[model samples]
Target: MDLKKLEEFILEVGAENIPLGMLTITNNSAAGQPVSMDNIRQTAEIYHSFGIPFFLDACRFSENAWFIKIRDPKYANTPVKDIVLEMCSYADGCTMSAKKDAIVNIGGFIAFRDPELKQKIAQNLIVHEGFLTYGGLSGRDLEAIAVGMHEAVDEDYLNYREAHTRYLGQVLTEAGLPVYMPTGGHAVYVDGGKALPHIPHSQFPAVALGNALYLAGGVRTVEIGSLMFEHVDPQTGEPVYAPLELLRFAIPRRVYTRSHLDYIGESAAICMKEAQAIRGLRVKWAPPVLRHFMAQLEEV
Candidate 1:
């Protein structure tokens, strides 16, 4: 979150209307960029001063921690786990999905600093989900999450993981592919707008590039730009647009080696060469909300 903008907004709104503030580490919607530790601390301070609790969407906490360790000079020698704890200390609680950093197959959990809030959460859990203990999951699943959390913070594993992602970005960039720079910990984002300038935003260029990647080499990717971020206004009927158009290739945890990424990069280069031939898409049918997730589209 932008602290300055938040402060101004809070002052304008008198802060009472806001219940809490949420921040995500390694924000997924924006090319998996990590939030700076100093920024997080300052945001926490701002929220606390306003009497608003700060929470974290920390699905990729380990990856974010590793990024901080290498990127930030202040945390150069700090252990990844220690850095992670310090980050968490600023926020009152966090919601986590074990599928990401934890490497668990399925399941998610929440942590809270307030015992009173935990008790309330337990009661709600029983009503909507299952018991507070397992929440419809078996003991084995919980064990996997516990162990995976520990493995996720291992310095060696994090080093290799981040390096692998950076390597893919470097290779694709060297091949003249328009990928986002300073490679994110999770994925390589291709700048679809620059790559497919012939296809305008209204025609969903990023979505077209994603489709082209799939058709070219059977490599599936998601567009994180206007196609995914923007939508048709139900009331005004105007098409809202996002600032940037991106095609993302999310690298699954411990799933592929450099050879696999090498093939992907080569495939992307080939696709870029044939990009002009790719046709843009127009939404044929879409729901009222989250249209990008399941919208039907056809060649424009």
Candidate 2:
């Protein structure tokens, strides 16, 4: 969930007096640090103190479930499905990213306990998406999601993925590269703050790291910082907050093996050891008429 945006929305809705609630805070394992559950709870408690009904974005419930089990083995016997349902009870409604937790190629869903709100939301969905019969997803994709959701909790599968992440983290750490301890989900984070202390945030640390890694080892990585919003112009665009420059290395589940991870670690180490400063370059960007994905960029 975009908590910053959500908080702003809450303030706008005149619900500043009402309490907000969130299930759990987990990091964008794909990004870097875990989202703080304590922070979320405090925010929710504040809203609750004001007598407002709070809702959680529970799309990543499965990941949180895995985290809980791994972090506290005493709860290992708890069923993830049950945990998800229980967590949903705290929220007025939830928006789920079926694609991630459900492992389907394309699917999403929203759940609410309030019948009136549920009906209203469903009505809106029917107009924007398809009817409940179709649910804006293909039948095959739904099937995949169902199967994937079931497999998402398998201890063996989760263990393998977790081990792989740890292995990647260990390799990078041992190589004396700046890495976040306690890797999250299925990604390893290269701490841009520590990796490139000399680089300023305004200079796009994540982008610099990504480009450096690519040049040093031919490995592709994405920057989580300012580079993500490179299209925004200083004069015309709004300012961005949070760490915009994070170099993220996402490990695909059941895809890349240990050997592949080793190669990635080796590449990262070499990049850290040999990276050079990047000189600034400026270019103009035009907003896309259609999909930005389809838009082409060329040197002017």
Candidate 3:
């Protein structure tokens, strides 16, 4: 969050009304850009001054630490684990999806302070998740999460993980498509609004490109665009769209090797060349909220 804008909002809305502040490292919605160490510390200070609890949605914490090590000069030589600790030190608590940073197949965990709060969370967990002991996970799953959590911060793993994501971005960029710069931690985002300029954003160009990528080579991708982030005017039934229309190729950790990325690059290159042939999509059916997940769209 931008400190200036935050202060303005706080002043307008009154600080007492604010309950919490949350930050997502390698922000998923921002094409995976890392939240800088400077930004993190300053935001913590601002939130603390306002008596607001600060938290992290640390899904990609490991990848974020890796980005900090390479991108920021002050932490250029800092170890990944130490960086992770320091980053966490600035937050009151965090939520983790093991599927992302920990590389686990399933399950997630929460980190927090305040003993009374912990008890409250445990009580809530029992109501929905299960016994707090293992949250209903098998012993093998628990073991994998424990080991994967540590391995996620390993130096070798961090290097390869970042490199793989960057390589895909480089390849796609070379193919003459617009890719988000400084390649983020987990995926390469193609600016589909630019890639398929002939198809207007109103018609869901990003979704069309994602569908094209899949049909071209059986490669799956997700659209981050108007369809996903748009808001609706309830009274008027007017649709409001997001600013950027992106299509992401999120690479799974330790899954595909060099050849796989090369194949994706070639497929994307073909998609770019044949972009004019692709058609935008219109929502055939949608739910009242969060429509992108299950909405049915047909070619326009």
Candidate 4:
């Protein structure tokens, strides 16, 4: 995280104008990079200095804790659950998609350090979601989350998870794919811009690379690039694109084995070998917002 850039943006925008500040622990869009505990603390200090409430997009909190334990020597011996608590200590609240780290099939929740805020949010939740009693989830689902959240922080499970993801990154790199190094917690992101230099960001090279991977071996991936982050500058009326073109392979928990990961890495390598033949894409139709989710495209 660039502390200078964040502080600059907050200052430029005026802190009073900002409603709240949020930090995604495993910087999801940036190759799922893990944020260190020190960075988290410093960020919280900045937000609080501006009288802004800090929140966490903590769906993958456990995974991030594991990274902190392994990467930061200071926390090398700390328990995963303890690391998770310390990470959350800096935030005023957190929003979690229980489906991720909690390992539940469905259900999500927002937590707040202030009871007044919780009560206020609950009112909105009651109107849009189900009653505050269940929060739109079944008893079974809630129970699952209760059990799974504890399991999510199990050190043994996290160790295996890291190893599993690292293996895929290694395989992809060895097979000549440009993978993000020091592989992140939950996903292996390929540098699509480097892998498919023949295709340009204007034409959505990451999307094309994603499509190629699917065609090669049914290895589905998501494009985190111009297709998702591009926008027209209201002032200049020119396109502003994401800095990196990434193809993310999010490894699901306990869903696939190492062998399955091998297949995915092999598939990406296959796509890379014939990357020159891969065509760029142009949007055929798209929604005004979140075009990546529902957009249709044609090869350019």
Which candidate tops lDDT? 4
Candidate 1 residue-pair clash tally: 0
Maximum-TM-score candidate: 4
Better of 3 and 4 by lDDT: 4
- Write the residue-wise lDDT of candidate 2 on 1-300 in tens digits: 465676676677777544445443345634534434444455556556556766766555666666766565655678766655555555566676776656666777776777997788778888899887568888888788778878877767777777888898898787666776678775777777567777666555656676667776787776565534444447969655335356678776677888887887787778777655543222235345432223222321
Model 3 stretches astray by more than 4 angstroms = 233-238
lDDT of 4 by residue, 1-300 (tens): 688998999999999999999999899898999999999999999999999999999999999999999999999999999999999999999999998999988998888999999999899988999888789999999899989999999999999999999999998998788899878889999888988898888999889988988899998899999999999999999999889999898998999988898888788779778888999999999999999999999998
- Model 4: how far residue 195 lies from native, Å: 0.6
The predictions' CA RMSDs to the true structure, in order, are 1.7, 4.8, 1.7, 1.1
As for candidate 1, its clashing pairs are none
lDDT of 1 by residue, 1-300 (tens): 788999998999888999888998888878888998998899999999999999999999999999999999999999999999999999999999999999989998999999999999999999998999998789999999999999999999999999999898898787676878878898888888888899998888889988877887788888888867786789999988877898888899999998998888787788878877988889899988888899999997
- The TM-score between candidate 3 and the true structure equals 0.95
Flag the better candidate by lDDT, 1 or 4.
4
